[model samples]
Target: MALNGCSIWGCAKALQPATSTLSLNSKHDLGKCGKWRRCCSSVVNGVESSFQYADRVQVQITELDDGFHKDLNMLPKPLTANKFSSSRDGTKLCVAYKGLAGAYTEEAALKAYPKCETVPCDDFETSLQAVESGLVDKAVLPIESSEGGSIHHNYDLLLDHKLHIVGEVQLLINHCLLGLTGATKENLKFVLSHPQALVQCEMMLTDLAVTNIGVDDTAAAAKAVSLDGRRNIGAIASSRAAKLYGLHILAEGIQDDDNITRCLILARDPILPETNGSYKTSIVFSLQEGPGVLMKALEVFGLRNINLSKIESRPVKRYPVRLRDDSKYESIKYFDNLFYIDFEASMTNPNAQHALESLQEYTTFIRVLGCYPVDKTDISC
Candidate 1:
């Protein structure tokens, strides 16, 4: 009479079975069982009598109280891919960049994945959106240029979007001052290029009293000069751009620093490469209000021996309420809120996980942007 392992419809005693009969296959049937009805029936006839009734009703019940726990334990854990094997043939890879065919970003993407179909965007933000909307598999955007400092807008965009910086490419930026076939430095009165390009050649531009014009892109400026047949105008761009636009280079290596390089970040879905060297993980978080909060946040990385490559702070736009007793709320500036960071560590390492666990106690928001192999090559032209 003892149905120790028996369960009506394999449900736990804490759970209620269906009021209607549970049909198994076309013919077999498990009679109606309800929590209240079963309980009252059990109390009246005793537990053994209820088991006998269940047997008569032909209802199979699992006796295990931890049925849900056992079922969950039986399920296989999720598996993850850990290698950089090339995607299958006919598998399309979308790469977004802001430039013409021979732009440096495009060149870098081609160098990284020669078979990828490149999508040309008009601006960097557009490139970021292309990847966000799933139009592209990845986007290559410049983060810092050796000669022009950091691209601040892109850094802001990195924080604004939920995209990850999966990998990086360091490309040598060789600036060529290009003009019409017969145009020379002496005849030039105006120079056209992207702001960064113009900054890189500031010294060269100073030597020649040329009016610098800011354009959307260096290659686009070269195309404009070539199309307009500007005999007195020149463009500071790459040699490849001059060739593409049918312009002649009046002078090459015009950038102040001949070894100028730009760091390009490749953004895509979270990619965990199987075999990588010297990995770096980037994370962004904001700390809760308290004294020693910043120090505590930093100690997590320090204790784990994770090198902080770069830490930057941007005001959280949504939260603008400042705590100031004075009437002049605008005058008193306080950088109370900040985006704490950690860098240059592999996620697979236990120390990195422990560091994040430590960080969770103090931080209000935390996100791992990506874990990628470090590109440590001096790509100088």
Candidate 2:
């Protein structure tokens, strides 16, 4: 049972998408079986193998065996284009996004998967549901915005759904003020857009001396003006939305800064990235309550030289507050939390595998969200 200088490989074969629960009996050491691999990857014997997975993880264990090979049931699968409705030619692929045809989500989808068909949904949840149900090959939704910060809801939604983070698309947002052909800034009375968009362009809206109105979406804002035949109400949307809705670009790039929204591409299955390329693994873990426990958990990565990219702590809503007594049963409280971390490492590397093994020993629960190619989008714009 000693892990001082030895590593054990408890390899779980790549599973079909049905069973996502990963089981690792405590009897085995960290390297034995960490979790699930994808279609092309698995840990064989003590050999660390390359895997492609639509990353997502759970569960308990029984006791000791040197070469234990109990099925961990790391439920995962790869996204195949077969999920899309076959056209007469059956060649073009389709992806889903929220909002109208010209909305930025759709733009990100098309930009990431050029020549693929882009389908629109009424809201963000629908896009995720569509991907989960295989109604579309993939779905794209924004996770973070540079100027305003993270979209907290999407982070929560990532846990609510079972889709994998197959890819990432970072789009430079350039907000355009759209209006009826005859409408000008001076004549505009009200400006409408998604609340976030409105916030992003608050200064510009104020400078125009126009009233700001928050609506469902920027594209819808443009659509409303077009349908109403209104000249006074303009929309803060994209130039593409302006063209699609038959509006003029009253102003362009009005956002507070060169804003960027990092969008996640979700598919039923995870894609396997190159073994040697820059990659990131996202995981969520709950830890035991004790001083230095978190530091001990984090040290695993540091020991292996696996750099962490992002670490987010979300309050555990179900157990938001834990009651403690001062040995006198007086009221004392503590916050229960879950840590979501993103680290730079390919799971195929032995060092990365060892790190997870060490983490398994230190944390109460851990789940791998996905291991994906790092988005190296040049930020010069």
Candidate 3:
């Protein structure tokens, strides 16, 4: 692979697709399974389709360059001008989400914007790019899950693009164990689904004592299991996926716990939230190397009585490692990370303005990801 530009796709070149069957280690009929299947129908036309094709070409990604414009220009011409369907008039909102029609991301997208036209994307980057290129009005991103923790890749993607986080939606996941029409738990040998879903259903799968295989998307997993036509091969997905792929639900609500996935809404332009409304502002910042650097940065918020809902740190992509040398100790290396915080206060609040102003003194770099109204609606149903 050649290191050309900063785009993750540009850093590598495509190799020929492998024709060999993927082997699974299990006591059951693992040898009967074939190669992994990609769901191309999930893709739309235009640049996103080009991105999907490009993603297939390259598997390994190296250091990403600073710009995505050069990579965007390398793609082939779009199949059609209107990538989304024509039936959706200009009045309707078009939103992009990663994975097949029955995937959880699509569910979250619809929950956030009920009437929006949901566009299925092959990958997270494609979904983000779709919004960046004006192919869709907004893109819904799964940021954190109550069961599996944070989706770190999307946090990096947030910094990579110029898009703004406009809002958020939380979805209660109800994972189901699905199989062929006549397939049952006793005959099933292995279960397949997204890695997160697999983890969520760990206890249930362990009880069944079947081999677990991780796929890209839950809906795609259901589709693959249905397409494989093997009674032994089952999938852990949503009830909707079972219906969509013509698979039978062997078990329902099979998740180990009550899991909730919080998805972020992204747009090309930022939304101005009303000051009086309940809002949560998200910001990312890097502090100078010091013992109390992070603590001091947080003190500003605490002083203003601004409640922080969440805080997470991600390693700086470009500068991951930093050398630390102190007079008392030998030279050491530490991960240089950027902290992401979600505070329960609107950006329009005067207290928030003062907090941020005070925060600037302690931070080397800072950027507000978004300030949007909180999604307090009960969506557990």
Best by lDDT: 3
In model 1, the clashing pairs are 5-63, 6-61, 7-61, 7-62, 8-61, 82-274, 83-274
Residue 16 lDDT, candidate 2, scale 0-100: 13
Q: Least lDDT summed over 10 consecutive residues: which range in candidate 2? A: 42-51
Clashes of each: 7, 12, 2
Q: After superposing candidate 1 on the true structure, give the runs of residues whose Cα lies further than 4 Å from its correct spot.
A: 1-91, 258-268, 322-336, 340-342
Give per-model TM-scores: 0.69, 0.74, 0.74
Ranking by lDDT: 3, 2, 1
- Taking all chains together, the TM-score of candidate 2 against the true structure is 0.74
Cα RMSD (angstroms) for every candidate in the order listed: 26.3, 17.2, 17.1
Give the Cα lDDT of each candidate: 0.60, 0.66, 0.70
Model 1, range 59-152, lDDT digits (tens) per residue? 1223223221222213221111221123335368868787764577777777567898876676777777766666677888777665666666
Q: What is the lDDT of residue 146 in candidate 1?
A: 56
- The regions of model 3 sitting more than 4 angstroms off are 1-91, 321-333
Candidate 2 structure quality by residue, lDDT tens digits, 50-85: 111102211122332333222223211222334433
Question: Residue 129 lDDT in model 1?
Answer: 70
